[model samples]
Target: MASSRGGSGAVGRANELEKMSIEQLKALKEQADMEVNLLQDSLSNIRTATSRLENATTALNDLSLCPQGLLLQTLSLSVWVPRKSKKL
Candidate 1:
């Protein structure tokens, strides 16, 4: 068993890794790479969701500030129409 070190954990891990067989190291590397890919995918999804939420919030704010008469028209397009232009 490897002893746990606080700040020097990486050094301890390196030492332990040095004692591992080549096949063990290769398997470990494969598992680490898979985890990294999964983390990257999850992060990408989170970013996409955050962006969508921001866009929805901005749309809601814009709708809240719009004049009452244009509410129906705005909902139809789901976007803010220019206040100065009556054209769709």
Candidate 2:
């Protein structure tokens, strides 16, 4: 069995970090907030990419435009397809 540091090792360090003085905690909070904002922005970008991919696939299937349009057309297709549930 692995010996626990009684919350004094890496986990302990993280706990201590959360309990630092107000000033230090505030600084940490600012950094964490910035990181959260960055992650949110990244998540938004990923969602956008996924949306574009889905749109392109739909357009291609609909024969609305050539595949080249998805790669080079200035306009973007941004429609969603509704999936129907099959009755078992």
Candidate 3:
């Protein structure tokens, strides 16, 4: 059940809208449309970021499963790390 406190219920909103002038209604509609657009754009960006993260994770998993020598060759590395400098 919906609460009617603070004039937040649908019936309360309808009564409020009924008291609003035409210009006020127009402005409210414009503001609502802008908010909807912003929300949709945010959703799209989140989905794209999620997809890119998934692809990167899958690629990392594939790389980890590759043969050790192949992995080293692909990285073109002769050693995992250079020997510590004797002077240090």
Compared with the true structure, model 1 gives a TM-score of 0.68
Kindly list the per-residue Cα lDDT of model 3 for residues 26-75, writing each as its tens digit: 99999999999999999999999999898778867866886564523232
- Show model 1 residue runs off by greater than 4 Å: 1-4, 69-88
The model with the greatest TM-score is: 3
TM-scores, one per candidate: 0.68, 0.55, 0.69
User: Which lDDT values do the candidates have, in the order given?
Assistant: 0.80, 0.72, 0.74
Model 3: pairs clashing at backbone N, Cα or C within 3 Å: none
Worst 10 residues of 1 by lDDT: 71-80
Model 2: residues with Cα > 4 Å off, grouped in runs: 1-11, 64-88
> Residues 35-62, candidate 2, lDDT per residue (tens digit)?
9999999999999999989877876676
At residue 81, give the lDDT of candidate 2: 42
